[model samples]
Target: MELLPVRPTIKTPAQAFTGDVYMTPIHSGTGPSRMTVALVRFTPGARTNWHAHAVGQTLHVTEGVGLVGTRDGAVLRIHAGETVVCPPDEQHWHGAAADTFMSHLAMLEAKPDGGDPTTWLEPVADELYEKANQQ
Candidate 1:
């Protein structure tokens, strides 16, 4: 057993998210391990753009409330202690609700051939957010 080197927190890119968001890499396995873990935080109303993972992703909510939405119009409200699994190539987004801050640990598996783990698309529009919030 060993301790991983510490790293600075990272701001989520504007091209991938809206509002205030941050992430800290926890671990990134090398070679055949092919896994990554990150702690992500989102301020109220902050969220990711539509995206998908090559090998899918999992999220374990740790604090506040979270909203996960899919392109096919499914929206799930998640709270602390909840886990969300996003299937590979499923276009979706996740973030904090408008009234609360949220935090989660994201787990992702990297493709063996070095393909991008995530493919980011357009941002979530206000209209969509409003509609989801109403549910």
Candidate 2:
């Protein structure tokens, strides 16, 4: 057994996120393992761009409240200690609720061939985001 070295937190790029978001690497598996995990923190009204994962993704909320929405206009409100699973290749976005900060463990697996697992699309429009918050 070995203890992994801690990685510095990074500010999520504006290309794929809105508002202030940060990510701390947790685990990135190698070789036989393909799992990846990160602790993602979002400030109030912050959220990710529309994206989809080749192998699906899971978010376990660790603090405050969050919102997860899909292209079908379905939005789910997640609270601390809750977990949400997004199906593979299903366009979606997730982030902090309008009035609170949020943190979650973002877990997903890399593509088997070692390619990027996520396909990031356009940012979630402000109107859609506001509608989500109102729901």
Question: Candidate 2's residue-wise lDDT over 1-135, tens digit each?
Answer: 989898999999999999999999999999899999999999999999999999999999999999999999999999999999998999999999999999999999999999999999999999999999999
Q: Where is the poorest 10-residue window by lDDT in model 2?
A: 1-10
Give residue 97's error in model 2 in angstroms: 0.4
RMSD of each: 0.8, 0.5
TM-scores, all models, native as reference: 0.97, 0.99
Q: After superposing candidate 2 on the true structure, give the runs of residues whose Cα lies further than 4 Å from its correct spot.
A: none
What C-alpha lDDT, on a 0 to 100 scale, does residue 50 get in candidate 1? 94
lDDT for model 2, on a 0 to 1 scale? 0.98
- Tell me how far the alpha carbon of residue 117 in candidate 2 is from the true structure, in angstroms, after superposition: 0.1
Clashing pairs in 2: none
Residue pairs in candidate 1 whose N, alpha carbon or C atoms collide under 3 angstroms? none
- The residue-by-residue lDDT of candidate 1 on 84-119, one tens digit each, is 999999999999999999999999998888777999
Stretches of candidate 1 exceeding 4 Å from the true structure: none
